[model samples]
Every structure is written in C-alpha cells, then in structure tokens.
Target chain A: MTVADVLLLALGAIAVGSGALVVTSTHLVRSGFYLVVSLGAIAGLYLVLGAELVAWVQVLVYVGAVVVLLLFAVMLTRAPIGPSADLDRPALPAAVIGAGVGLGLTALFVDAFRWTRFPSPDPGTAERLGEQIFGAWVLPFEVLSILLLSALVGAIVLSRPDIGARKAEDA
Target chain B: MPLWLDLLIRVAAVMAGFLVLPLVIGQAEHKVMAHMQGRVGPMYAGAFHGWAQLIADGVKFVQKEDITPRDADRTVFRLAPIVALFPYLVVILTIPLGPGLVAQSLDIGLFLVLAVLGIGVVAVLMSAWASANKYSLLGGVRGAAQLLAYELPLVLAAASVAMAAGTLSLPGIVEAWRPWWLIWQAPAAFIFFIAGLAEIRRPPFDMPIADSELVFGYMTEYTGLRFAFFLLAEYVGIVVIAALTTVLFLGGWHGPFEEQLGWLWTLLKIFALSFVIIWFRVSYPRLREDQLQRLCWLILVPLALAQLVLTAAVKSLL
Candidate 1:
C-alpha cells in the first residue's frame, strides 16, 4: 500500500478506537478527552486526504471549541476523579445500534465504489475552497449563514430573559 | 546539503529557537520588571546581572518534589504540562523567520497556528479539573469563559488581517504588507495585539490566573517540573504572541537590507513587542473578570468587526 493509504488506515483505526472509548469510558471527563482524541484522529485523516483547510478547521472548531466547551461543562459539574458506577447502562442495545450503523455504512460504501480506484483530487487549499463556496455553492453558504445567525439570536434571547421582557411589558 | 540534511538543519534551528528565546524573554521580563519597580533583580546568580537566573530557576524546578495530590487524577494531571507546551513548539515550526527560512510552511499556516494555539486551553482545563481543587476548577472555568469570549475578537481581528492580505499564509501576508498598512491596519493591529495578549493570559487580561484571588488559579495544585512547564509555556506563549503581532501587524522581516538581515529584523520586532508586553504587565493591574468580558465583547468584538469591514472596503477599492 502507498504511504497515504497506510497512514489513512492507521488514523482511521485510531479514530474508531478512541471513538469507542469516548462512548464506553465510565469516567465522564476521560470520555470527553477520548472524544478529543477521536476528533483529532479524524482531523489527521483529513490531513492525509490532502484537505489541509478542512483538517485545521476541524481541529479549530471541533477540538478547540466544541470539546473544550464539553470539558468545561463536565468540570463545572461534578467530575469525580474516578469512574462513577451510575454511568453504567445496558450495553447490548447500544452495541446493536452501533454495529448496524457501521455495517450499513460499510455496505453502502462497498456498493458505491466496489474496489474501484479513482484519481485523487488536488489538495483543497483555502483559495480553492473559497472559489468553490463563492462560485457554485453561494446560495447554500448564504442559507447556512442565515441559519447560524438565527441560532445565535435564539441563544442570546434564551440566555438573557430580560431581552424580550421589556418589549412584552411595553406592548 | 542533501535534502535530509537541509531538513535536519531547519528542524534543529527551530528547536534551538524554541528552547532559547523563551528563556531570553523571561530574563528580559525579570530585568524590565525590576527596573520598572526601582529594584535590582537577579544580581548574583551569574554575577552578570543574573544572566543565568532562569537557568538557576530551571535547576531548582528539576530538583523539587514532583507532587500529585492524593485527590488528583494522576494521568490527566501528568499529561497537562505536555499539552500546554506542545502547541507553541508546533506553531514555531510554521513561523517564517525570513524568506524561505521556515522549518515547515503550510498553505494554511496562519490557520494552523491559531488552531494549534487554541488547543492550549484544553491543557488548563485538564489540569484544573484533574487537580480536584475548588480553586483550580474555578480558575479553569473562568479561563474557559475568558478564552471563549476573547477568542471571537482574536479570530475576528486575525480574519481582518487575513482579508487585507488576501492569503492565510504568514509569509504571504508579510509579502503583501506595505509601509502604508502600518497606518491603515492600525486598528486591526491594536485589536490583534490586545486580543493576542488575552489569548496568552498576560497581565491586564489575566483574570483566569489572577494569583491574588485564585492563588495561581489552575496552577495552584501544580508543583516542581510540571509547574515549571506551565511557567515555560507562559513565556513561550509570550514569544508566540509577540512574534505573531510582529508578523501580522508590524511587518515581519521587513526592514533595511531586505535580503540579508531579514531574520534579524524579525527578531528585533519580536523583542520590541515583547518589551511592550512586559511594559504592559508592569503598567496595568489584572482586569476584573466582568470588566474583562465587557472589554472583549463590548469593545474589541465590535471594533474587530468594523476593522474587518474597513479591510473589505479597502481591498475592494484597491
């Protein structure tokens, strides 16, 4: 196998293994850290796939912001140093769902590509990605921004009860 | 030299810079702060104005007991220092000292640097939570909140410069820089420098580690080499922040004898900015937590947005 293929396989293995640890680890804070490892491995996979912008953004938004927030929340609450017995739940249903999803994705991928090798695309630099987004995907991009903006507004309103209280009182 | 030798030399040079420059900045801080406060600092260690004070400190840190609290999570507590220090090492690799002088240059060098730097927060959170100290946990939560708030303006201010330069590469941004940009990008530059200071948790933006209130904050539970690592990381952070401010705003490697002495110019600017950073520490007290948040969201964020718009307008015009 080519170096990229081998690297991809290794990173994928790490991602899957850490992802399993993220779900199965009884320690809440440790599970959050495992999620970080899983996400970081996925970013490595993106790097191996030659999507540098996506890889770094994945690290930035997910690892840097999302998981930090998750860890922050876990810490803000009771995060016992050792594993808590209360975290334990029936594993059978979770395993069944997980396996079904994994198998379905594998089957779909196999059905679609079936061992065919396609030429790799050029690396996705910021400039090229920008062109793609602004050139062909402008409408969807704009829609996404609007959606995010609304979500942001919703959050602000929810967080500050006084924001809409005065308006209602005036009415 | 062969390709391997060339790569080896570059890596060694970056590593040497990474290890040495932070100590230099630390010594500078000691001398500057001492002088500013009208006191003689570190006069005995090396007998030459304590040139070896940090080295002495290093030995002391190494000799001390490595203590992990009984209640602490051993694994995560042990892991924190490495997490704190590693990002700065990665960042230095991408920073260009001169034309073609970088150890490794990525197409998205600026983004990579910022992203990696953001990961440093996880270290603080990890240590704070793993220590199982109420003070450390409080400090960590404050740090997260502070970082989360300031991150917006920090990224936004950087985005302004990236927009102005029209490339996310650090070297490309320097190449795109002009003398007039010192005036044009001044606001964005100011925002960037201040926000960068906050990002690194320097004084006046140091609510998270307000030692007076939180007893070194997240670092309260740490001792020995781990504590020393945190200190080293802070100094390295200062170096990174100063270097970034130099590169992004002050026109890195852009001085007389442009071809030669380019790296010297970059170093000069970095040291100058580092001096200013120290001056800031000596001049201002730690900002209150609410004041810090208010300053970031109310002032810096709006100002960064305005600067971004100005950059866009100027870019469109030119």
Candidate 2:
C-alpha cells in the first residue's frame, strides 16, 4: 500500500479508538478530551482524502470550538475528574442499537457502490469550494445562518428565565 | 548543497533557533521592562548585562526537583508541557525568515499555523485539569473562555489578509506586498494585533493566567523543568505571534537591501514587534475577564468581519 493508504488506516484507527474511549471512559473531563482526539483524527482523515478546507473546518469548528465548549461546560458543572460509579449505565440496549445501525449503513453503502470505481477528481481547492458555495449552494448556506441565529436566540431565552417572566407580565 | 544536506541544515537551523530564541527574547523583555521601570535587571550574571541570567535560570530549573501533587493526574501532568511546546516548533517551520528560507511552503500554511496554535489551548486545559487544584481549574476555565472568545477575531483578521493577498501561503502573502504591505489594511492589522495579544494570553488580555488573582493561573501546581517548559512555550509563543504580525502586516523581510540580507530585516521587524509586546506588558493593566470577552465579541469580531468583506470587495473590484 502507498503512504496515503497507510496514513488513512492509521487515522481511521485513531478515530475509532478514541470514539470508543469517549463513550467508555469513566472520567467526565477525560471523555471530553477523548472526543477531541476522535474529532481530530477524523479531521486527519479528511486531510488524507485531500479535502484541506473541509479538514481545517473540521479542526476549527469541531475540535477547536465545539470540544472546547463541551470541556468548559463540564468544568463549570464541577464534573468529577476521577472515575464515577454513576456514569456506568446499562450497555446492552445501546450496543444492540448501535450495532444494528452500523451494520445497516455499512451494508447499504457497500451494496450501492458494489466495488465501482470512478476517476479521481481534481483536488478541491478553497477557491473552487468557495465558488460552489457562493454560486450554487448560497440558498442553503443562507438558510443555515438563519438556523444558527434562531438557535442562538433560543439558547439566550432558555438561559434567562427572566425574559419569559417579563414577557408574561407584559402580556 | 546536496538535497539531503540542505534539508538537514534547514532542520538543524530551525531546531537551534527554537531552542535559543526564547532565551534571548526573555532576557530582552526583562532588561527592557527593567530599564523602563528605572531599575537594572540581571546586571551581575555573565558580567555584561546579566546576559547569562537565562542560562543560569535554565541550569537551576534543570537541577530542581520535579514535583507532582498527590492528587494530580500524573500522566497528563507530565504530558502537558510537551503538548504546549509542540505547536511552537511546528509553526516555525512554515514562517519565512527570508526569501526561499522557509522549511516548508504548504499552500495552507496560514491555516495550519492558526490551527496548530489552537492546540495550545488543549495543553493549558490538560495542565489545569490534571493539577486538580481549585486555582488551576479556575485558570483553565478562564483559558477556555478566553481562547474561544478571541479566536473568532483572530481568524477573521487573518482571513482578511488572506483575502487581500489571494493566497494563504506565508511566502505568497509576503510576495503580494510587492508594491505595498497589508498594513494598508490598518484596521484589520490593528484588530489582528489586539486579538493576537488575547490569543497569546498576553497583557492586558492575560485573564487566564492572572497572577494576582489565580497565583500564576493554570501553572500554579507546576514546578522545576516542567514549569520551565511552560514559560519557554509562552516566550516562544510571544516570538511566534510577533513574527506572524511582522509577516502578515508589516511585510516579511521587506526592507532596504533586503534581496541579499532579507533575514536580517525579518529579524528586525520581529524584534520590534516583540518590543511592542513588552511595552504593553509594562504600560497596560490587565483587563477584567468580562471586559476582555466583550472587547473580542462585541468590538473586534464585527470589525474584523467588516474588514474581511471590504478586502474581498476591493480585491474583486481590482
């Protein structure tokens, strides 16, 4: 196998390994950190696939912003740094459902592709991606912004009970 | 030089530069700040101007006892300093000190630098969590908040420059300043410097490591050589940020007779920026945490975004 293939395999292994640890690790803060590793490895896989912009967005949004926020929440809540007995839950049902979903997706993908191969496309540079985004995908992108805006408003409302109380008094 | 030999020499130079540059900058900061405060700093060591003070400090740090708190997470505590230092080494590889002097010239060099720098947050978080001290935890939490807050403006500011230059490569950005520098984008450059101060956790944006409040912040529990690594990483970070500002705004290696002596010009700009950082530390008081966050989200973020849009518009028009 070539270097790219080897690197892909290594990254995939790290992603899967850390993902498993994220669920199983007893320490709350460590679980958040493991999630970072998993996301980082996934970003590495995106890089290996020659999607530099997507890979960096993954690092920036997922690994940098999302995971940091998660860790901040955990620390703010005074999460136990050591193993906590309460974290353990009944795993059989989760395992069964997870396995079924995983297998079904794998079967669907393999059956649909059926070992077909296509010519490799040109590397996706940021310029090309920008054109595609702003030219064709602009509507969906704008909609996504609105969605995020609403989510921000919702979050603010939820965090401040006084907003609802004031509105009720006004009514 | 042969290909392999050239590669080896570049690696060696970068390694040596990383190892030695921090000491020089640290010493310069001490001396400059002292002189500003009307006191002599490091006057005795090595006889000249306490030039050997950092050397002595290094020796002392190496010889001290490496202590771990009983409740500390030993593995992460040991790993944190290495993680902190890793990005500084990686970032220097992509920065061009002169024409054709960079160790690597990836197209996504700027993105890689910013992303790698983000990893330092993980190191801070890891050290803070592992220390298991209330002060350390408080520091780490502040670090997380500060990083998240400042990173938006920092990336947006850099994005404005990248848009103006039409390339993310450090060398390309430098070359784009054939006739003029991105300092023409004065507001963006100003936002970048301000946001960058927060990114490096320097004053007055040094809320994470507020010494008076948090007892050196997340580094409270660290001692000996491990502590030295943390300090080294901070100074190296200061140098890196200064170099980045020099490259992104002031024009990297662009000066009189720069064709033959470009690296010297780059060094001069980098040190000038470093001196400004020292000046900030000496002159400005640290901001309150809320004020720091508000300055980033309310002021800098909108300013940087507007600058980015303006840059894009100007680029398209031209």
Instruction: Say which candidate scores most in TM-score.
Output: 1
Model 2 lDDT tens row, B239-265: 899999888888899988989899999
lDDT of 1 by residue, A69-100 (tens): 98888777778888989897868988999899
Query: Model 2 — TM-score against the truth?
Result: 0.95
Candidate 1 local lDDT, B157-222, one digit each (tens)? 889989999999999999999989999899988998898899889998887788988998899989
Model 2 lDDT tens row, A1-171: 999999999999999999999998888888888898999999999898888878878887887788988888888887666887888786999999998999999999999999899876667667778899999999999999999999999999989999988998999
What RMSD, rounded to one decimal, does every model reach?
1.2, 1.9
RMSD of 1: 1.2
List runs of model 1 lying over 4 Å from the truth. A166-171
**In candidate 1, what fraction of native interface contacts survive?**
0.84
